[model samples]
Target: MSNPLSEAEDSPLFITSLAKGLALLAAFGAGRPSMNLVEMAEVTGLNKSTVQRSAYTLEALGYIAKEPQSKRYRLTPKSLEIGSGYLQTSELIERANPYLHELNRSTRESCNLLEPSGTDMTYVSRFASHKQISIHVPLGQRLPMYCTSAGRAYLSALSPEEAAAIIARSRLVAYTQNTETDPSRLAKIVRKAHGDGFACSNEEYYVGDIAVGAAIVNAEGRPLGAVNIAVPFSRWTLKDALADLAPQLVNTARSISNAARGLKPLVSPATG
Candidate 1:
């Protein structure tokens, strides 16, 4: 595929320096909470000088800080404002929160609201089950579309051709022994989700984690996101989940979709 950033590099309006600074920030993630200049350079594919400059700028802006002892740069609490701003202003999330809470209360299981971002689904909101569990999913987690129930549910709401194209673009790497990497088989699962009104994953992403999801659509039938309910494998079987929880999940998703249709359009440019 063509590199969009590379293509934009020559444009007069494109700010290479700003992009580099953002890339430096993006390099810090779940397992990588902090990094030294050399590590930043390696992760961001930037030179030491560029990493130093970006880190300096971020530190000055209070987005990141250099540790006194380790000299490793880490994001500051202020950096959370960026994500917090989104959560605060998201009409969809606000509308879905009450229903998500209701689902959580009724099922006493982990529930999440995930939105599509490219070939992956991103968690925008999450409610943890108080019950003992093996997995802990935090907000802002991103998982592959093909192997995740939420992702497949979102894809299932799309046209077959569109869903197939997205699956084609995915890496399809096996995340676990049970992860299905075959594109054709993945397509079949998506089709089943379309017919069934919900999709499920059987320990594809994480061991002992089973999840079912249904897509939230706009009035026009475009999928905006997905609502997911995840349970531990030791406590629930796929048959039990399908028989007991799928109806609730699908109904909750449908209710959210109906509510979302009445929301005003967000004042942001479309990413694509």
Candidate 2:
């Protein structure tokens, strides 16, 4: 498969410094929240001097900050503004918010709006259940597409070949005892989701987390994302949760999709 970003790198308009800065920012994640210049260079594969320059720029921009005692760099709350900017601008989130809240209210479970990112599904929006037993899935958290209900739902909306290609590219490691690591088995599950209009994860990604999801499609039937409701195993059985909540989840997904299609085009008209 051809990489669009790599292809763009050959364009004269491609800004190398901007790309390097973004890469430097991406280098600081959950596992590596705080990094020294050497660590940042190692992680981003940039030289020390380049990393230093980019780090200084990011620090100046308030996206990153250096610790006084450790001399390590960490992302600041200001960096969240970048993601917040996206959420604020997204029509999908706007359209899906009410439905997500409705699903959460009806199911009394944590509801999520997830979008596929390469081989993972990222939580873009969430409505936390007030119930005591609910699982907490924060926005921007990425889960393996191979073992998640949202990922499977998104896959189910794709063509068989496309879904297969995505699964082949995924690192199908067993996240839990229930996680189906075999490509063939995972494919079968995705096929079932395609037919059933919903996908289920029975403690696949996390041992105690059970979720059911349905794909949100555009007017062209292309998947925009997925809507998921998560419950803890201690409170509800997978069978009971699917039996009770599946219909509501599918309906909520459809409502969001329809609302999304009704919104005005995001692109601006070309001016002469």
Candidate 3:
């Protein structure tokens, strides 16, 4: 059998079955949560016969269910279970879970682990630390990278030219009063974040929500993602938070980075 993935170097995601299975699930969207075989083929850009076979495979695996009346396909709760299993084993969640609770206990603010997905960022893992200023979103919530502290830190790893190009292509709307809309201004911020080893946002992405994040670098100094601490406006002033908490944020980032670089793990391994 010929390799479909090697045909496109951009997509190293080689496994045909896995790709088709995920594509089938992604075919269902907001307005069209349920899709027929033809609609799935249209959405996925796959052949109708391919969609039919994959849909059958997905249904057998309990990842999707066939709507008997509508003759449409919709994701099953089991699909979400598969995603949850990935989240459970993810290095981000494994390392950040305890720290999130600790930050919550000390500062009473929520914490999140963000992973860069192209020009977007996703909260792959998060812990609800504060009851008062909690934001509503699921585990896989994706948002614009240009407007967020976590996203900014990831962007910081890029060259100024590459960074500017990304920002230019992004939707720089005023998500909040402090959101940086100007491309030049945002580029400067990303550069500074690279230099400072941290990124800061004061009610920029979301109103009354301030966030701070630092880049996580691996052994080759390549950025892995970003770890962030979010505090509600009612919790602390920007001046006070930056002064008191910045050191902790930077230290935590360093710890995570070092761990990823084969340093001592945060959690001790089980002994036989």
Please provide, for model 3 over 187-230, each residue's C-alpha lDDT reduced to its tens digit, 9 standing for 90 to 100.
Answer: 88898999888888889877888788887777766667787888
Return the clash pairs for model 3, or none.
none
Measured against the true structure, the TM-scores of the candidates, in listed sequence, are 0.93, 0.93, 0.75
What does candidate 1's lDDT look like per residue over 57-164, in tens digits? 999999999899998999999988878898898989999999999999999999999988778888999989879967777788889999999999988998898888
**Per-candidate total of colliding backbone pairs:** 0, 0, 0
In candidate 3, position 256 carries an lDDT of 73
State the lDDT of candidate 2 residue by residue for 1-272, as single tens digits: 66667889999999999999999988878789899999999998999999999999999999999899999999999999878898888889988999899888887788999987777888999988778854556788999877999999988988888888888888888888888999998899999999999999998988899899999888878787899989889988999988998999999999998988754433211100
On lDDT, the candidate that comes out on top is 1
RMSD of 3: 6.7
Check candidate 2 and list the clashing pairs.
none
lDDT of 3: 0.75
